[model samples]
Target: MDDVVQAQTGTPPVRGAEIAVDGLAKHYGSLKAVDEFAINIRSGEFLALLGPSGSGKSTILMMLAGFEVPTAGRILIDGVDCTRLPPQKRNIGMVFQHYSLFPHMTVADNVAFPLKMRGVGRTERRRRAAEALKVVRLDGYGARMPSQLSGGQRQRVALARAIVYEPRLLLMDEPLSALDKNLREEMQLEIKRLHHELGITVVFVTHDQGEALTMADRVAILRGGKLQQLSPARELYERPANLFAAGFIGEMNMIPAQWDGAALTLGTGERMVPPTGAVVGTVGQGAVTLAIRPERLTVCDPVTPDALQATLREVVYAGAGTLLIAALPDGTEIRARVASASLPPALTEGETIGLSCPPEAMLVYGEEAAA
Candidate 1:
């Protein structure tokens, strides 16, 4: 934990100089792009802003990076009001999905641009450029142009350029989206390693849940221009704030229901007790929504009396797992994934089976159960 924070500490430590966005709001004509956005980013924390497209995740990032101006609210970095600060004066580093490297310059020249702009001597600039390249593990490729490298390598060069000057905060926008899956995963690890090595505060924005989960020390989820939840990966996964968050962050089976204090009784007469201390709204008595991840559900072969009966709808081989689609007796469809090696025996469409889910794995929400 110390190592994590140390690696993200800026070149000149800004002690207690955290970022605070208070009551941030932005609009475009009649559409509210961001509303009442607020987040406190610690000086050396690796934080991620995650949401679906058009969910205003990137807009908030742009606002923080000085690319977009908020219509309302204030932004403070290290307790300094920087809401109106120009991008160049912010002393922030940024990289984006497009690999915004200088196509005309060699990798070394590109990396040295920031140091040179900051008036470093020629020798020191070249030395820092070499070190940055080495940090990205691309030392010998300094002579290559952006076109000479693969997508991942080009992004690394972009990263090196962003960090060569050791800015106080680093912003990345979908930096790995252009790479192939394997390369993306490799670069994700590399970014995490670099973040650990540099200790520069990072504000990462991405729509990829896996990327957010793998990299961020904490994640802030956005939806409809509002923050839905901000928490550690495990907490966000285990306890989403609402139906939108629960459904968006991962695969879930949402069932409609009527809340009766302790248990939710479905229209089909099925009842589910939530995990202890789970918060279900008071207005949820008439109608409520319940969510359960696919992996938490099990198929019972012997047709147990209490198990919900479902008909196997489809089976798909998903490399590491077999995905099964089942519909309950009342036409409620649910998806579940069983380990591929443990694929059920010859289950076919239309075969009736029973399924069971532990109470602890269920999540209930919404005013009326969602169908």
Candidate 2:
């Protein structure tokens, strides 16, 4: 595949084109499917559009792919306005959740379909088709029909077909959602590798936070037809912009508190300081939500200052760690994940425990934050 692409295009196969979406929006009557969504996708960057259902991630993707026209705004590919172009004229490729391979076509023919439509010569199409199959590690399976392949292999075929033309941009809409957990994980790595090898700008949409965090160079989180935040996985996880972003990315223990200049006062009379140099412009206005991740907390003897006293209500033993769910003196519940080796051997439900975390590990957000 690399050889064929290089031979024909006179450029390395692993480079990508840039894309920009400006104030993109879609409307269904009075309902806004996507509103004022905008972002720049760097060349060769893998970006994920992540959000819950009806958040407009898919609607934005559809607009970009030309499947759905934006009610307003424009889409640019490598600085060219492609907003009004048809899907085929955009020189973009797409893969859907359902592996849309034609059951009647053999694998090679399936991959060659796009080239055939584009008027490539028969000889070149066959060569490129075979090379594409090999690129996906499906070299000798070209003669096999779609029904003869596994779900994952069929998806690879779909991918091969999408990429055989070496599209400048690739749009994948929940392509891995159909597979079981293990296979889904396996394909995640495969897709990541393919992105690196091909260097094609990719815009992927999914509701799975884990997938977005694991695969994307940057993730754009959306809700209520608005973008909540766009950042790298680590930053999005460790320093979320607001309460909604904090709670949506991963499991967080959100405790209601009142912020003073130096610290937060929990309802139970416990004072917790924010990490040094942490921004708190919104913390002083009114009530705030102090967010802490489960792994950042430690369960210990109730003798330390800055620790909250709680009663363990449940102990969940995950394979790698134990999760302790506890209720604070004010009746607020919190969770902590302790490694199996460090958990107290005799820990029991209803036992008193102290939960502590460094002040720097806390995220404070204003009360009016919305999803």
Candidate 3:
């Protein structure tokens, strides 16, 4: 923040805090909501906790916010134990999926609510509130009540209130889920810009993979209360740790097969040689799954060398790309995503065609890793 803004708000620039969650586990009777979850959040980093329903992402976030205490483990914020700290004392700004603004309060008053709670005088509160509203690009809209604003504007007000206190860390729970598609995308960029300007450590929770990929520095993938993988978005998509992660992040084609150390025998008894280190183990032989990304598979002529023959089942036209669904001799289906402009004109439904995925692009995984 610039000196002028800091002077007006009478608050120092916010510095992001590092958080270490060690052996964190939350249990509810017989159910383990979060199991042995551990991760180090870097200072000023935007980290996303992502998972499907019942995956314990919300449980972890609640534990971090002091709304729910863990059954086991510790939460350290900047090396200080905050496991039992009350929500009020944690100095963490939180924005929920719902715009939890007070309908009776004007935007400015809402933004200044935190300062009022801290016992700042009326004049100072107004000054800080105005600056906060300006920071959210609501400049002169502070006098309007929450009911009078659009959904996007209300979300902006919620964000304004979150940062108004100059909290060291920010926690967001799917804050954009309430908006329309375009508005949701717009708010994503807005939050990104705000994070850049404030440089506060942000812990975001969402089930949307696109949001996690677009907004976060690192993504934590969770399932059945256990962490599946945590990595940057690209690596998580390109080199997933297991079959569960590979199938979860995006479109993945999984083929059941038998591996004999050097080659694979598909369900149809077709033989194929895969690159070295295809599977991750010393045994290197057993029931395996050959996984390939839709974009990595190519549709080609039946005469092509090393091609897997299939009958084109359907053609799905997606803007900027086409999804080709093909059925193998054994009736196993696989899809290929190709550029719309690069697709062959002769390709059509029921056309006998050849599909080829390079040996290196095929990801081999043992069957036991299935979700």
Candidate 4:
């Protein structure tokens, strides 16, 4: 984690190929699919628009790709207003969840489709397609038909086609959703590698938390068609802006609490201060919420100082780790994770236990009405 922070210090400034969007809004028959959305995308950076269905993540991507018109606001790429630009004119490559490859065309021909549309000569198109395939590690599979290739290979072909023209911006709409878990992880790394090796600005859209966290340099989280938070992956994970962000980013132990001027008192009568309490100020007494990640909570014998007593409700083994759902004396549930090797042997359910985490690990947020 220290290395992760140090790596941030060396991050390059926003490149010139930046994207500027302001007050972008879209609607359909009074349904606000995208509402006053705005974000600045750094050039050569891998940014992900992450949210569940109907959260307008894809709408934002479509607007940026010039497929959907925004009813309000403006879009600028490299300081040039592209609000009225056509899809093809935007020079943005798009890859969707579906392969969208031509069944009749071989991999080479499919990769060459964009080049041919751009009026490149057959010889040059073939050469460029070959180069693009090499970039995706599909060099020799050029002549193979889509039917002959596996799902992952077909997706690689789609990726190769998208990059064949060397577009300045790349737009992906859940491109790896159709693949199995193992293949999806492989492609996530591949896409990340491509983004770095090509230095192309990418605006990836996905609802998968793990996918967004693993591949994106920055994640833009949306809810109800509005931006909730935008920040680097670790920051968003460890310091979510609100309850929605806390629950969406990862597995969290959300417990009711009340905040005093100096500290937040959990339902279990345990008090903890946020990592950045100074920035958020001391939340005064009243309803509030404390967010803690499962892995942040510590479970052990001898109830360390500052630990809240709890009862071990159950322990579920998850191969790499064990998830313990425990209940505090006050009836507040907290989740804790321990390495599989460190899990207690034959621990009985409903056993009295203690759960504790460093004060800095706590995230406090004001409660909000259910949406």
lDDT by residue (1-371, candidate 1, tens digit) is 12223444544333323799999999999999999999899877999999989889888989888999999999998778889898888878899989877889999999999888889998988888887788788979988888989988898999989988777788999988889999999999999888777667898999999899999999998888989889998888888777777888889888777777778787678776667656534344567777889998777863675566788889888888888898876788988877887766678888887778877787777653121
**Which residue segments of model 2 deviate by more than 4 Å?**
1-12, 279-281
Q: Write the per-residue lDDT of candidate 3 for residues 310-332, one digit (tens) a residue.
A: 89999999889999999888899
On TM-score, the candidate that comes out on top is 2
lDDT of 3: 0.88
> For each candidate, what TM-score against the reference?
0.92, 0.96, 0.94, 0.91
Over the stretch 54-158, how does candidate 2's per-residue lDDT look in tens digits? 999999999999999999999999999999899999989899999989899999999999999999999989988998887777989989999999989999999
TM-score of 3: 0.94
Candidate 1 overall Cα lDDT vs. reference?
Answer: 0.82
Question: Which pairs of residues collide in candidate 2?
Answer: none
RMSD in Å for candidate 4, one decimal? 5.5
Candidate 1 TM-score to native = 0.92
* Minimal lDDT window, size 10, model 3: 1-10
